[model samples]
Target chain A: MEEILSKLYYMTAFSSFTYQVAIMWFIAFLLLYLGIKKEYEPLLLVPIAFGVLLANFPGGEMGVVAAENIALEGGRYKNLFEIAHDHGIMNFLYYGLIKTGFLPPVIFMGVGALTDFGPMLRNLKLAMFGAAAQIGIFAVLLAAVLLGFTLKEAASLGIIGGADGPTAIYTTIKLAPHLLGPIAIAAYSYMALVPVIIPLVANLLMTKKEFEINMRQMDKEFPAKHTIKNIKAVKIIFPIVLGSVTAIFVPSSVPLLGMLLFGNLVKEIGVNTLRLSSAASGGIMNAATIFLGLTVGATMTSEVFLSPKTLGIIVGGFIAFAISIAGGIVAVKIYNLFAKKKINPLVGATGLSAVPMASRVANEMALKYDSTNHILQYCMASNISGVIGSAVAAGVLISFLS
Target chain B: MELFNEAVSIMIVGMLTVFFILFLIVGIGNLIIKLSNKYLPEEVVPVKATISSEPSNNTYAAIKAAIDIATKGKAQVTNITKL
Candidate 1:
């Protein structure tokens, strides 16, 4: 009887069963439900949910737990090998992929491969809406400062407004890795909720006339396809020029913008390197996303994630997202006041970097208001521009804050 | 107060910089479009030579059939000289 009791006591699982662990297990289940049942960004959420589950098992230590023994003498971070030896594979992945700031730039390269700059090029003026939408970042930054968070923390929290999960993750990793869990979760969750969030904001502000653009009626208004070869040449040169110009002014943006432009160049260059483009956009992207999601989720161990600051970040992020949508819509309305050939204001809501998702939401809303709107082409202009806008915002934050 | 001031500066500088960059992209992209259109103009397709459309078809078909029968379908009309 004594031997059996001792064995049970020695078992880490039996000894470590606490209410906090139970709550973490519940949180993991919640994430799984959101991913599997609701189908919200399941590609990311499912892997993240599994990582969360893997982390809470009492003695597993498969998560990126801090090295209690390794003391920071004077704010010096632990090197990769030191981190790996102390904390294991999850920590190694966290340090190598997340801390080294490698995954986000590579992910941007894949995004650039997937993107088409045609719509943005055709509707050049409309791309300004994408830049205007970034007001949410600064608005939230100010709000965070008023709430007593440090400038670095504010920057991380504010990037959630850009509506790009990877950019938010990249900024957080650079500014405040401690808040990575909450910030990443908020950014991705808001991105998935774009269909809901954008419409709610847009519906309140926009009128029926704003959603009324018929592609059939505008057949003659649109330009002919006489410049096809010219368009292709411009597409090839756009990334290289944009990357060089951005790096010249904002030197810190070079790493992220450089990779993004490189990816776009590979895709646009020609058919000779089609296989390379395919690998970057498809295989490598999916792999990086899985690793990034899992490691980010694994970092959300109970003690760090279940705090007042996490709650604050979640709330602040939502506010930022709502404001971004509003900012885009307002920008289009403002532009319409000055222009003779007015564009559908519904296209403005796509200014967030949720990509084609936000644009799709805008299109759906336009259809609801007027079935013949067909504003998708124009919306793509703003949507693609939003991707660049968010990257630029991330660059600015990093340049100024870091 | 200091944090608030920094946040203000970041907001102003960041928004201005983004707008400037995107504006440059717009300007450069448009310029490229205009230059390409000017320099690499599309070739004008030459008009097809007309040969009294209806009469040519009927006469050519008859001549083709005659040659086919004359050679027991071994020889066919390969070319016709204006002379």
Candidate 2:
């Protein structure tokens, strides 16, 4: 009886694996708690946490769960979390979605469709605001280089400052795939926390006097004819012209810019609105978001995420974002010098990669400063400017380095 | 002392070089955006409800003839024919 009991103990399976699985579950629960309770970027994070829960289980699957090396008879597994050595469903998910660089462009097309170019057109000054927001990219690059990260690694690390999650992922996947896990997580986490993160940084910028101004009226709806004609030119030529420059100069950036532009072009010409809108709002975006969150979570598998280097990346990303804000503020002040009318400094805060959130927060902050002041439109101008500025910066970096 | 001077000179030159480079990049970006907006912008706009044509030789005289004597200069009137 004693010998038989010993054999039974020896045969017990997955004890070690079980412990790892439990830790992963706790982390997933933590993500869920923060997403729900904190109300921090809930729309994206809720789905992301659910994806993580599905991913962290033994042989974590994409949407389905099963025991054994089993499928429906001859079908293959698609789960993202399998034993480390075994290429579980997770492996196939990473291979088909991430390794191929497929999700971002499709998402970009949606961004194009949903994006309104009217604000950017009405407030051309916003372009300067966009340019100012990119200060963090170079500042972080310099810091990374000084810290002894190799040049390629430094550049990859520096891109976190852009604050745009897709842009960061696109750049890093091309430049340093090995660092993708930490980089992507850090980028997305900050993006998801934009509402919390930006307001604190923005509050310091304007005095009590500045915060009281109301800029809601400045959110002028552009004249319909101007929008109908002007928007197409910007939407159509923007990707093509920028893509060519980025590709020809920084060939390394071609994959990212090319696909991003193609997606935008689909929306600009307004052909196949169904397919384009679906890419943005339907299966592709949802599936990609789920995959992006899960695969990134898979990377957090204790062995990889628990490191001094990962911590460094996170800290560096925050600094980069703050620096971007300072840059935009400074740009606004400089523009004020040459132009007759002045813009609120709060608008400068929107230059960070958080896009419209920075603009909204800035505009709201202005309303706090004064009831009569209208600066949202002006802030939006800068917000759009930052987008172009970062893309241009990416093109510049790739051109010089590649 | 000699080494210190060389270090100072190198530091100054390095700082200047970085400053100039940053200025050039940002300056060029600003210039491109400004020039594009200036050179490529929306066309001129014309106001509605203001007539260019005149029934009389002088627009002022035509206005005087069209308006009521009591309301002259307060609410100028245009000729019905012009409408």
Candidate 3:
């Protein structure tokens, strides 16, 4: 009886089953803290954290994954911490959504549903700003290649510069699934930090005169009697055309491009707002974000993040950011020359919308220059264009790399 | 020393790779547009405002419109809630 009892205890001790669940539970709490206390990208991050918590709970898909680490590299990196490259909740999320390119575009669809593209259409030059913002993507890609990342890995890392979450996640999964864990975490974290990051960079790049200079608001009257009859047709055309082009030129990017276009297709179809919004904003998008974030965060288990490779991603991302900003500024200068009226250079900053955060930052900076000066909405117009631009650049990069 | 050497190597090779790709894209994008104009169906007529009335774009327009609506003599008239 004593011997049997001892064996049972041993089996349970070796399992680490309860402990792994505890660890995931702790992670969930941390995500909640980040959401409630820190208020860091709460809408997306909170759900993500909870997903991590659930995934890690014993018998919750990730339990078996954590158990494997103890068997395999569990003892190899004794002194050093090890991030589970495979197995567990992170593994499931990665395989299901990130690898499949399922979630980000759906999230983007929701984003599209909520978005007003009016500003982007009005200022044709904001299209240039959107293009300009993509400089970071190339800059980072090159930097990654330089750091001895292969073409695919370089492409994956460089996409962080686009600062669009779904595109980065999708591209990385295609180009370098191994690096997805770090890249996704980095991409979303930087997006959350954009208000802090871009402001610092923007201020460093421009002077008070450049920032303060207010351009007169353009008279942007919505075209009267806009017909929806053909709007759906034109909308459908964008996805089909872009999707076909992407598949033909760069098949690797087809997943990202397809998902995005599908979202737009749903929007264009416009018959079922309920299903469209559900596909875009509801359970599917939310569940994926939750899964994407925690699983990504869980993947960051010490060893992976501490490497020289991570350093490469970090530095490469900033290189991308600076170059993208420079591209915007350069475009603005050239646009100013030919234009009859001088537009505010600050509008150039909205080329990357961490949603309204970057746009608002540009607006506030402008407000400081002239209290009555209001160009916040104009900056936002460019910001949305930047989101589209980032997605396109990612698609283009994936095409080239693949 | 090794890091510096690596950096120089990366810069040169990376710069070339970037331009090569960018050139191809710019070339292709323009080519497609030109080719389309030369070959494909006509009439995807975009908006017809030659000059942007204000230097700013839709962001400004939306804000200005909202403000105008907000500050109107009878601001209550533009009660958007009905929509």
True contacts kept of each: 0.62, 0.00, 0.01
Question: Candidate 3 on A79-139: residue-level lDDT in tens?
Answer: 1123334354355554455556676666666666556544543344445566666767766
What value does the lDDT take at residue A172 in candidate 3? 78
Model 2 agreement with the true structure over A1-402: per-residue lDDT tens digits: 999987776666343356656765686788788779987666556655665566655534342222233233566643444432355566556555665567655555455555554566555545656666776777777776666565556666767777777677666655666577678767767876666666777666655644543344323332222222334455455555656654554455455556655656666767656576556656666667777666645545544445677777888888888888877777666775775445566777787657677777766666555656756666766666565556556655544444
Candidate 3 stretches with Cα past 4 Å from truth are A1-32, A47-93, A217-254, A268-274, B1-83
Docking class of 2: incorrect
Model 2: residues with Cα > 4 Å off, grouped in runs: A1-14, A17-23, A47-86, A208-251, A271-275, A395-402, B1-83
Q: What TM-scores do the predictions have?
A: 0.88, 0.69, 0.66
Interface RMSD of predicted model 1: 1.9
DockQ, ranked from best to worst? 1, 3, 2
- The DockQ-based CAPRI class assigned to model 3 is incorrect
Cα deviation of B39, candidate 1, in Å = 3.5
The top-ranked prediction according to DockQ is 1
The stretch of ten residues in a row with the least summed lDDT in candidate 1 chain A is A219-228
Which wins on TM-score, candidate 1 or candidate 3?
1
Among these predictions, the greatest lDDT belongs to: 1
Q: Give the clashing residue pairs of candidate 1, or none.
A: none
